[model samples]
Target: MFCQLNKTKKRWRSMFTVVLTCPKEQEKCKLPPEVCWHIGASISNGSWLSQFLSVFLTDLKIDQIVTFLPLPPRALPLQELVDELYNFRDCYFETHGVEEAGRKQSDVAKEIEKTLKKLEEKEDHFKHKAEFLLQKGRCLNVAPDFSAVAEECLSRAVKLEPGLVDGWNTLGEQYWKKGDLIGAKNCFTGALQQSKNKVSLRNLSMVLRQLPAADSAAHAKQVMESVDMARQAVQLDVTDGTSWYILGNANVSLFFSCGQNPQLSQQALSAYAQSEKVDRAASCYPELHFNRSTLFQYEEMFSSALGGYSRAAELDPGWEEPLEREKQLLEYLRKVTELLQNKGKVKARRLRTMLSNLSTSALGPCSSPEFRSPTGRVGSLEPRTLSSLTQGHNAGVAALGKVVFSLASEGRMAFTFGMVDSEETCIVVMVYNTADSWGVLIGDSVVIPEPQVKRNSITHKDESFDFRSIRVDSPLLLIVNGKKQNVQSQLAASVSYKPLSE
Candidate 1:
C-alpha cells in the first residue's frame, strides 16, 4: 500500500487529508474505524497530531508520508540575532541621509530595545545583552535630544562589560556632545587604556586639541600631542577616512594655535584630500567641509571657501554655523568690493601726502632692522612696497601702507581693513588676535615687517574681486603710527572646538 498526504491552511486553521491506496485493487483503502483520527484546531496547536502522524506512518512503513510532516522551528542563537540587528542598524544608517538618519535611528533603537527585553529573560545571554545596549546607545547618541537615554544605556553597557572599548568611545562621544570635555577626555583615555584602537586615538587627539592649556607654550604642547596622536591613529588604519580627517583637524589646530605655519596648512589640506579619496562618505561630513572652508578662507581662496561652506550647509540643513559663515564671508567680500570701487575717490594729493608721511621712526624700540637673509646671514633689511612682496611668506621683507578703509571685524578674532601702499598698490590687511582698543582707523600709517601675503581673485555670484592681502597673526607684529602695539592690545586666543562630524 502507498500513502499520500495533502495539507491546506486558511486563516489560523489547517487541514490535512491522507489517502491509502492498495496496488492489487488499484483503489483507495479506508482505515479501520478504530484506527481513524481527526485533528482540529490552529496549525500552531496541532503539534500532537503532527507527532502522532510521524510515528504512526513510520510504524506502518509509510516513510513517504512521514516526510511530509512539519517540524518545530528552531530558535536562533542570541549572538547571531544581535549581529543581524547590528548589521541592519548599520545598513539603515548608511542608506539614509543625515537629516533622515535620526528618525530611522529611532526605529532601529526600538528594535534593539525589543531585542534587549527578550535577552533579559535569558540569563545566559548576558554578553549579548551588553552588546545590544551598546548598539542601542550608539544609535540614540546620534540625536542630541536623546543624549540622556543614550548616556544611561552606554553607562549600563560599560558597567556590564568594563572592557568594552566601543562602549567607552560611545560614552565619550556622549560626553563630548554634552560639552563635558573633562568627562569625554576621561572616557576616551579609558578606552585607550583598554586598547590602542584608531577610534579612541583619533577621538583623544580631537579632545587634546580642545583641552584648556595654561599658556601659549602649554597650548602648543597639547596641539603637538594632538597631532602625534592623530598620526598614530592614521598609522593604525591608513584607510580609515575618519582618522585622516581627525589628523587634518589636528594639523589645522597646530597651524592656527601655534605660529601660522604654511606647511602645517598644506599638511592639513593633504590629509583632507587623502580622506576624501579613501572614503566616499567623507563628502557627507559637514565638519570636514566646514573646516576646509575655514582653511580656504585663511588661504585667501574665497570662491573655494564659499563653495565649501555651501556644501557643508547642504550636508547638514539644520546647522546654522555654515550659513552664518557664508553670510559673513559674503558681507566681507561686499564691503571689500565697495571699498575697492571707491578707491578712485581718494585724491592723489592726499594719497601722496599719506605715503610721504609714513615713517617707522615712531616704531622706536619695536623696529627690527636686522633680518635673516636667504643665506641665513643677518643683514640690514629694507622695507619693500606691498606690490613687490612675493606670494606666501615674505620672511625677510617689510612693507609700509596707510589704512584707507576699515572693514567690520570678522568674528571676534580679526580686524580687517583696506590699505594703500607707497606704490599706489591697494591691498587688504587682516590683523588677528587684536583687542578693540587697538583701533585700526583709515589713513593710519601701518608698518608690517615679515608680512605674509596672499594674492587672491574671487568671482562669486554677482561680485568679482582681484586683490592681494597681508595676514598679520598678532597685533604685536604691527607698528601703527610709529608706535608698536604692546601685548596689552592683543586678544588672548579663544578655544572653539569643532565636532568630529555632523
Candidate 2:
C-alpha cells in the first residue's frame, strides 16, 4: 500500500514534508510509529544535531527557538543525551556479540562515519536503507554543527515510502532542531496523515506554540487553530502525559504569542495539573514538571513554583531552563524587596501585587520605551539638561537612554540598563537614533544556546526581520518589520551605538 504512495510522491512534489518508507522488520513492528528525533532542532532546519552532538553541548530548548536561527557562540552542556547514544553504540556491539571496548566518547565521528561508509553500498530494501541512514545520522549528529548527508539519507528513505511515519517524523525533528518551526510543522503534519501518532501531534503543537504573533485577523485565526490542533492531539490520545504536557505549553504560547484570551490561564494550569495527575509513566516526562513550575512562577505561587522548577532541574540535571528561570525569579524577588524599601508599605504592596498578577507579562509587543519622561515622571532631554536619573533610586535598575540602528538586512536596537540605586546610572549618558518607522519592543526574553553567557550582545529574529543588539535582560529591541525603502547597512554607523549594560 505504501509502495504505491511512494511512486505518487515522485510525480507531485508540492509540500516540503517527507514521505516515510515501510519498516524493514514490518511483520510485527517493534520500532516507534513516528521516528522524529530532535537532538537539537531550531527554526532554520530541524537537523540541529550538530548543536547537541559533536562536543556534547546542549543549552538550546524549545522556548528560545524562533523562525530565524543563529548558531550559539558557546557550548551548551549535553552530557545526558550524549551518554544515551553511547549506550546505543555499545548495545549495538553487544547485541552483535562483538567484544572490542566501546568507542571513545570524544570521538563521535569514527563510528558515525563508519556507518556512513556502509551506507555508500547499495541496498535492495529501501526500508533497511532508510533505517541505516537514520542510525548513521543519529550517531553523526551530536553537534557543534549540522550534516546535509544525514538529512539526505532520511529524505531518501521517506521518498521510498510515505507511510514510514518514523522517517517523516525524524526528518521533521531535524528541522525543529534548527528552529525551522514551519518545516517541523509540515513534517509532523505529514506523519499524522499517515497515522495518528501522538508524538508527532505533540511536536507539531510545540512548533506552532513558539511562532511569532500574527497581527492580521487571518493569521491570528491560524494561531488559534494551531492551538486547537494541539488540544485535539491530547483528546485523540489520552494515555500518555506528553500530549497533555504539550497541550498545556501550547496554551501558554497562546497567552504569550497570541493576544489575551481570558480562559487561557486556567486552561494552561489545568493541562499542567492533568499531566502531573496522569498515569505514573506520563508523570515521568521532564517537560511536565518544568512547564508546571514555569506556570506556577507566572501565577506568583513562588514557593510552589520554586519546588517544581527544582524538580525539573533534578530530572534533567543538564537542562538550563529551570536554573535560568530561578535566576530571573530571584532578580524579580530582589526588586520587590527594593520596592518595599523605596516606596514604603502602601506603594510597595501595589507593585508586589502587580508582579504577582503580571497584568502585562514578559510577552508584550514592540512599543516605544516608557521613558520615565513619557509619563511626566521625568522630563525629556533638551540640549543642555542633565537630570539626576538614578541619584536617589536604590531599589532597581533604571532604563537609561536607548539607541536605534539600521542595517540592510537587519536592524539593531539597545537600551542601556544600570543599577537604579548605583552611581553608574548617574555617570553614563544614553543616546537614541530615530529611524523612519521603528519602535522599541519591551518584555521579550532572548537566550542564545551556543555561548550560554553572552556578556556582550544578543540576537533574535522573526519571520520577517533580523535583530542584533546588547545583552541586557530586557533591553529595548530595534525593529524593522515593515519599512518599504532599501535599508542601508551603514545606517547604524551614522547613529551612535553602545552595548547593553548589566
Candidate 3:
C-alpha cells in the first residue's frame, strides 16, 4: 500500500495537479454523497471526509455532508482517498524515522557505486539518477575540487544534451568556487557562447567581475565590454539579484578606467553602493558584503567595515574575514591601551583601574597584568667600550667605555687629536664615522652603500692645539666589513684618523 501510494505521489507531481471525477458528469464525481463522504473520512487524515461516509451513510446530515465535500474535484473516491491518506502518513514516517534508518545504513560508497554503474549503462529511465550523481560531485567541487569522474559525468550530460544549461553552469561554477579565476572565466565564457540564458549570463558576469586587469589594455577593454553585455542580459530579467550586481560591476570598471580622479572614484563608489542596495541577502553571495567591507575600509570607517565583514560571515559562516578583522581590532585596542597607560598622568589607583579595564576589554576577561622590575633590567642604553686608538697607528681606532648619556647603552669616549708641532706642518685629516649598520648572519649578508656628500665645511687655525677634528656633516653607516653592526649601547664614541698618507 505504501509503495503504491509513493508511485501515485510521484505520478501526481509529474502531471499537473488533478481532481478525480466521474466521466458521465463531465464535472463532478459520479460517486454518491454517502460514498463520497465515506471516501473523505478514509482520507480524513487530510482535510477530506471519505471515511465518515464509509461508516455512516444512514445518518441524514446533508449540510454536514456538503461541508465536508470540497468543491467537486476536491471530492474524492474511497480508494483514491485511502491512498492519499497513506501517502501523507508516509511523509510523517519519513520525517520522524528516516534519519535513524539512514544512520544504520553506513555503506554510502556501495550505494554510490551502484548508482554510478546504473549511470554508465546509458539508461534513459535513470537520467535523473545520473544527474543526481553529477550534482553530488558538483557539491564536493564547491571548494572547486576537480575529480576526473565528476567532470566526466557533467561533460557526458553536456554531450547528451548540448543545450543543458545546468551542466555548463555547474562546470563553470565549480571552477569559480575553487578560485581558479582563469579557468572559471574560460568555462563561463564558453557557457555564455553556448547559451544566452539569464542564469549563464549571471554566472559569466560574476566570474568576469572578479578577474584582475589583463596585461594588454586591449584585452582589458574587451573584457570590460563583455561586462556590459552581461549586465544587459541580467537587466532584461531583474527579478534575480545577480543581474543588477553585474551592472554595478560594469560601472565600476568604467570608473576604474577613469584613474585616480576623485570624480571617477565617487562614481565607482556610487555604482558599488547601488549594488549594495540590491537585496543580496536573498542570495548567499559573500562577495557582495566583502566588496562593501573593502569600500568601508577605504573610507576609514572602522565600525562599518567590521559590520560588513560580520555580515559576509553570517551569509557564509566559513568565511574568515570577519573573524580575522575582529582579532586585528582587538590587537590594535591593546596597543592603544598600552600607549595610554605609559603616559603616567593618572593616580596609581586610577591607573590600575584603567589598566584592569583595558585588560578586560582588549585582551578579554582572562588577561592578567605583567609588570617588569626596573632593578635588573637595562633597555638599549647601557655603555660598553671598543679598543682604544694609538697615536701612530695606521688603521682607524675603536674605543670602549662606561655609559654616560641618559639613554646610553655603553660608556662614552672623547678624544682630541691635531697635527704634531712643527714649523711647516701641513694638517691632513680624514675620519670615518660608523653608525646605523646592522650585523650579518650565516646565509644572510648586508650591503652598505657609500654615503652621499651633501656639504663640505672646512675650518683652519694657526695653532695646532687649537684645531678641531673636521666634522663631516652627513649620515654615516657603521659596518663591520660588508655587514652592519648594532650598537646596543647608546653612548658617544667616535673614531678619528689623522692621515698617515703624508
Better model by TM-score, 2 or 3? 2
lDDT of each: 0.73, 0.43, 0.39
Ranked by TM-score, the better of candidates 1 and 2 is: 1
Candidate 1 vs candidate 3: which has greater TM-score? 1
Would you list the rank order by lDDT, best first? 1, 2, 3
- Candidate 1 vs candidate 3: the lDDT winner is 1
Q: After superposing candidate 2, which stretches have Cα over 4 Å from the reference?
A: 1-128, 134-147, 212-219, 257-262, 279-286, 341-502
Rank ordering of all candidates by TM-score, starting from the highest:
1, 2, 3
Q: Report how far off residue 152 is in candidate 2 (Å).
A: 2.2
Per-prediction TM-score to the true structure, in the order listed: 0.70, 0.43, 0.40
- Stretches of candidate 1 off by over 4 Å are 1-128, 214-217, 344-398, 422-424, 450-453, 489-495, 498-502
Pitting candidate 1 against candidate 2, the one with the higher lDDT is 1
Which residue segments of model 3 deviate by more than 4 Å?
Answer: 1-124, 128-149, 177-183, 209-230, 246-284, 329-502
The per-residue C-alpha lDDT of model 3 at residue 194 equals 83
Q: Write the residue-wise lDDT of candidate 2 on 383-492 in tens digits.
A: 11113322322121223221111121122222221111111111111112334343332221221111111111111121111111122211122222211113331122
List model 1 lDDT by residue over 193-264, tens digit each: 999999888888988887788988998899899999999999998998888988998898888887667899
